[model samples]
Target: MSDLLERLRGRGWRMTAQRRVVAEVLDGDHVHLTADEVHARAVTRLPEISRATVYNTLGEMVTLGEVIEVATDGRAKRYDPNAHRPHQHLVCGRCGAIRDVHPAGDPLADLPDTERFGFTISNVEVTYRGICPNCATTA
Candidate 1:
């Protein structure tokens, strides 16, 4: 079983066939796939699964804090299953490839007192954009 599946089961999540397939499709490293991409992959494993089911399952997972919905640049939102970890995203400027990057230090602590305008900060999102090695080699 995948980590996401294990976590879901630990949380007493109901494991339906459609939900299982969606979770299975999302199990992997560097897996940042859009809803359509997830639906397409799920169809390969279970042809009867519907797009609505995938979308709804994803929404529920996000609501449960089991998945992260990443919207990079105006493109379709991609779902990431690394919600339990503290990390940032590395985006490929050319192909829009996304990878989970664990960099040293805390971004939340980097903010100075004056930088904050009286609002208490709870979370910080940092995105690093660059041409990935694959894109650089092909260029």
Candidate 2:
């Protein structure tokens, strides 16, 4: 079972055929697929599945905190299923590929009291941008 599917089932999320297809399409490491891309893949598994269904399922998953919506490069919002883990993004500037990167310490602790402007910091999002190996080799 995919991590996203397992988490959804554990949370008592209703498992419809369309939702299941979407979850399966999103199952994998470094998965950051846009709604259209997800819909395209879901159509391969279940021919009757609609684009709206994929969009709605993704929205619900994002709302439920089971999936994370990433808008890298401002092209389209990509859905990430690795929400249960704490990690950052490494994006390829040339090809726009994204990968999950786990750096050493706690980012929350890195912010000192003096640097914080008084609001409580609940989370942090870090994105490292550079050319990926494939793009670098091609260039």
Candidate 3:
């Protein structure tokens, strides 16, 4: 997205071919790609792009709030590009597949009043883990 690039440029980021390729690889709906996976896809378009470049670009995007880093099972972090809206993750325990899900109630409401500990809570992350339909059917 040109708008993303312009925002990046405004943040003093030097636009490079590799960075552009990385951004292109991540632009899509429900895209949850690891750094290595992103590098592999970016290489298809820009053969010269390196893994480090992809990692760096991904980090930059996350820092800019254009991407969100999700850690499932403490394995490789996945990069999610759906940062425009708020949602939580529904993760498949068997295949590690992730999908965005909006739960029924406000997450902040679930926190116990005693647990606030005098700190203002600005956000919350709720991750629901279970066997996905494909995994459950095969079992």
Candidate 4:
């Protein structure tokens, strides 16, 4: 994510140490973490980092296209750093685990032309919800 940091720096983003730490926290971990979760982890590394700072940094990153937000439900939104790739998400219905997935077909094709009411369609996000293996085994 050094490249991302450099790009953000070139874009005139204030490279505060807190922001760098926040970026490192997201970059080092592959899992999708909610803002609260991210703040919790960041606190361990930099106790002075406030929740607002983390939230602001995350919002800026999202706006800059350096991150993506994934919502498994109506609850907290998780941040995904794998923004460079095009993929979908498979969410566990019972345990809330999320796995990145790649479907075989173009998802946009599934939206039949008849469904288009003359509006320009841009993108699609498909989330498949099911019981994960570990959760299934427990049940």
Candidate 5:
């Protein structure tokens, strides 16, 4: 996403070739790539790109709100580029495939005030886990 790079530029992010490659790897619909995956892909374009550089670039992107992290199984975190949209994640418990899903109602509303515990409620993220079509067919 060139737009993302431009926005990062506007925010004074130094444009590096490695960061650009990483961003390109992240740009697309339903893209949920882990850091190792990102580094693997980025290495194809930037053979010199190190894992530390990729991690730093990802951290910067997250700080800039250009990417959101999803911990599907608490093992590895996936980076989502669709930060502007409000949605939840549907993860395949078997194959670990992830899909973005939109629910019909307000999920946060399900938590009534009684359960708020006197803290300010701001946002909600729901992760639905099940077998994906491919995984189901294979099984």
Candidate 6:
């Protein structure tokens, strides 16, 4: 996307072939890829791209809020490209598949005043883990 490239350029980020390939791989709906996965996909377009370059590009994207890093487990962090909107995550516990889901209500509304502990809270992230429909059917 030209908009994404413009934003990155505005932020003083150089657009290299590796970085461009990484960004292209990350662009699409429901894109959740790890650094290695990104590198694998990027190499398809730019065979000279290295794994380290992919990781660096992903880190830059995360820092710029162009992507979201999701830790589904204690293992490698997964990168999500749906950074334009605010939403929660639904993870399949069995297969490690991730999906973006809108909950029924504001989750923060459930937090009581007593839990504030005199500190101002500006944000909250909710992660719901369960077996997805396909996993459930297979089980």
Give the Å error, residue 36, model 2.
0.9
User: Which candidate would rank higher by lDDT, 2 or 4?
Assistant: 2
Q: What TM-score quantifies how close candidate 3 is to the native fold?
A: 0.88
Worst 10-residue lDDT window for candidate 3 reads: 1-10
Could you give the C-alpha RMSD of every candidate to the true structure, in order shown?
1.3, 1.5, 1.9, 1.6, 1.1, 1.8
TM-score to true structure, per model: 0.92, 0.90, 0.88, 0.91, 0.94, 0.88
**Candidate 5 has which clashing residue pairs, if any?**
none
lDDT per residue as tens, model 6, 1-139: 5456667778888778777777778887678888899888888899988877888888989999988898878788989888888878888999999888878888678889998898788877889999999989999
TM-score of 2: 0.90
Q: Comparing 1 and 2 by TM-score, which wins?
A: 1
lDDT of 4 by residue, 40-64 (tens): 9889989999999999999999999
Total clashing pairs in model 1: 0
Candidate 5 has a TM-score of: 0.94
Residue 24 accuracy (lDDT) in model 3: 79
Q: Model 1, range 8-110, lDDT digits (tens) per residue?
A: 8889988998999999999887889999999999999999999899999999999999999998777788999988887899999999988899989998889
TM-score of decoy 4: 0.91
User: Where does candidate 3 stray beyond 4 Å?
Assistant: 1-12
Q: Where does candidate 2 clash, by residue pair?
A: none
Shift in Å, residue 100, candidate 1: 1.4
Instruction: Candidate 1: list runs displaced more than 4 Å.
Output: none
